[model samples]
Target: MARFVAGYFRSGRIPIRGVHLAVVLTFSLLAVTAHAEFPLPNHGESVIVGGDRAYPPYEFIDKDGKPAGYNVDLTKAIAEVMGIRVEFRFGSWSEMRTALQKKKIDILQGISYSEDRSRTLDFSPPHTIVHHAIFARRETRPVRTLEELRGKKVIVFRDGIMHERLKRMGFDRELILTPTPAEALRLLASGKYDYAVVAMLPGMYLIRELHLSNLVPVAKAVVSEQYCYGVLKGNRELLSRFSEGLAILIKTGQYKEIYNKWLGVNEPPRVTKELAIKYGAAILVPLLVILAVTVLWSRTLHKRVEARTAELAQEVAERNRALEELRRHQDKLIQADKMASLGTLVSGVAHEINNPNGLLLLDIPILKRVHDDADEIFEDRFREHGDFMLGGVPYSEMRAEIPRILQEMQDGAQRIKRIVNDLKDFARRDDAGQKELIDVNAAVQTALRLIDPTIRSSTQHFAATYAEGLPPVLGNAQRIEQVVVNLVLNACQALPGVDRGVSLATGFDREQNVVVIQVRDEGVGIAGEHLPQLMDPFFTTKRDTGGTGLGLSVSAGIVKEHGGTLRFESAPETGTTVTLSLPVPAQRG
Candidate 1:
């Protein structure tokens, strides 16, 4: 019935676009203008954006000799919202690269990222992907791969990704270099070269615009890579702004419009007037019949409704009173049921974990005692045999390592017991634990020992500064250790590579009379707006990486329980510093 009635109204050609279009237009305007006035560095000063002169559609100078292409338009859109003045400099691809190298240009609007280029340049997240193809003239033998071009003459754009790739792969023999993709394709079409390698889109675009009909792309995608904006290495300020602007354009749907205008295959399917007319009557007759039937049914339903109105009203009042009474009882019961179920689950999980940890707790010490008794025997065997393998390491090496490994196991088992205890406490709504006067440095050091493997893999540079003359704070040592582990691991994960560093420091704040532990990382930093919510329950930016958002929130609660505070300070591309402060315990004298 709904389908037929909808068809009937649509057949009359009712214009339902008025409201929908208005809503869409309003949001588009809002999206674009929301950050239109964002202030940029060196505001009002024109930053030179560089691009290739002969690369069509992506970036190029038009017949009027102005920078006008997909890259140009996209850059303009970004500049508008980012509120930066940009001037376009169009030249040979090599010259543009040189300009960027010399710092004469502040941005390269289009460049594919490569490790070789990355040595001297930094990139924003890719905005699009570029596919390179091998081009040959019609009636020539097709080459599917670069190896097929072993003896054939080949042309490639100078200083381009393909050129470097060919050199690295030892396919550089008989290579001819052209200044731009357009010139290379033009040369290949004029039979100046056996084949040319260029970006597929620009090759296709130039063929249509320049009327180079004889040239054809023989291979589809010989090399595909992320196409991005490039800046001189260490120009993070400009890099971040462009990246943010691109994100905004994408979120606003403006990026799709620009992409469709240039690269997107936008040929809309056509509908013929004759075909529409042929099906028009077939659709309309059934719709009219359905409309009549619906009207008759609605009239009968209206009469029936009127007859039951008074009786329904009386029943509704009686039911409402009973329902209100029942709902009150249900709410309380549901709350109790939920709490009971959760407590059971927590207790069950804790016990299940304690089962295995119990073995490590009980068995590891016996293993250690056995190792001690046999150490003398093993030493005699080693002295005579010059060392044999034990558990994949020489017995001499294992002699020292075994004790450390066993001790680590012992520490790990104890930590597991503590964690299980914490879980059981959670189940019973008990945060109570025996407090001790903790040496802030010693507790943090123990936590570091437990997670040393994570820190080693995450970064090459790590520093620990244990400040002296710090008064001990009263708290559960394991809980304090738990908070330190969380903060350090969060720092390690924030680092993008092993080259970045993570540092931890302990200090005394005489003014606040609190001992402070600071964990810092040279990683991608958090945004300022997120700082306040960092300690809020169930809020996280690391959700994609298995973050439940409870780490900081739970750690905050732990610190609060010990009469302390947790604070975060950070910014993009810089790093984050998490400070945990515990107040010094008062004397009872």
Candidate 2:
């Protein structure tokens, strides 16, 4: 909603009008000025009262778009007691105050009674007692003494009674200000302002309504001011009538009843600024100095944090360098393990071929003797009985049978030789070696041999359970061996201090076309929470005991390379079982 105000500019200096003057000017000029204070007509019908609509629990808008509050109800009660009809007018506090001053409203409800105000307006006798006190955050003690506040920042409502009291007490006038008590207290409670002094009744209501725990009353009512009705000065008849009505209410105890209804059961401690300064100075000054010191200390700590951050960055760089070196070493180990596996396979193939090659060598001489005897017989027949031998039918059949037998032996030797050549090519780890189908079981066994010495020396015992007739797996043999070896060595480490054995088991899942290997330990089990982080590189529980934390990560990488998965399950009181599953070779079309 855009609110507009009217004021004519003259010679670059805008002239201001009083509340009533603006109303009259608007009527004559046929203009509507939002700031103008129009009369809330009495009409010998209703007693009119004006209040700050934004002020809560005194006079403000309610959910139904109607005026409501203690003051609103009190005014109606006062009118009922006086046998008069009543009407309410709502506006901002500044506008309401101006309206009251302009004789536009007969009364201003919720006015705090003060002596200085009496000179300009007639005040009804005090209707209620509301103590005034200071509030601060729980983290900050309330300002109980004037001396306690000497060097601290305090807040007060502009032109409020507290401001006057502070001035009278010779307080330094540099405190912060807000337009209303609520704003000042709000700022104080939020730590934006150090302290605020408000009427105890309003403060209590605010604290409860705002659900503010940190705000509390500390100082004694500088003066226990009363809440009274304020009438414009020179309105004696109206003023007298209000006072008489108030007296009747008071005499009937209705006023006290109303006061108690809103403010009973709240009896805050009584503390005066004089008492505060006398007993609180010794405690207050030291705390203030400590707070100052703490602030400085925190700033110094921030600088140290920056320095530590730089140190951490340097450490990260050094760690990266070390990780690169470790990666290179792991690559070398993979290559070496591959070569070792290849060498074993080649040696096995050579032994297999040696038997067939020796058999062929022994059969060759007999085969040659048969051929020579036949050739001599043929030559003699050609020289003497060639025609007769040509006529002999069974002799050609025998020669044909002998040659066929020799050819069969030669073919058998050739097949064995070809198989041996294939083994050599497969085992070669030179630059020209290509990926090929491999026996996963053989790879696993070879890896066991390579890491067996390390496992035996590091742990208590070892065992193997391998399943036969496993299908071939497609992978780099060396990489797969490295993976197995690292897994075995890690299992061995987990079994430290345990006299029990570590078991390495391998099998195949026919349906899934995958080979599964599990390495289990009867050593100490991994804690549940620590299991999740075991494969995270550089995260080790054995920092003090010599663990690099990289072995598991590397093993996991190798399994992934072979289209495989590595997983584990462990319990705190039991043992850990690490399983690796590699896919079997894909079928050829």
Backbone clash tally for model 1?
0
After aligning candidate 2 to the native by TM-score, how far in Å is the CA of 499 from where it should be? Answer: 99
For candidate 2, write residues 457-534 as lDDT tens digits. 876667888898888887788878877887777777777465767898889988978999998887678888887788
Query: Can you tell me which runs of candidate 2 are displaced by over 4 Å?
Result: 1-44, 54-60, 146-151, 167-172, 265-589
In candidate 1, what residue range of length 10 has the lowest lDDT sum? 1-10
Whose TM-score is greatest here? 1
Give per-residue lDDT, candidate 1, residue 277: 59
TM-score, cand. 2 vs. native: 0.37
Q: What is the TM-score of each candidate against the true structure?
A: 0.41, 0.37
Q: Which lDDT values do the candidates have, in the order given?
A: 0.76, 0.64
Model 1 misplaced stretches (Cα beyond 4 Å): 1-41, 266-589
Instruction: After the best TM-score superposition of candidate 1, give how far the Cα of residue 140 lies from its true spot, in angstroms.
Output: 1.1
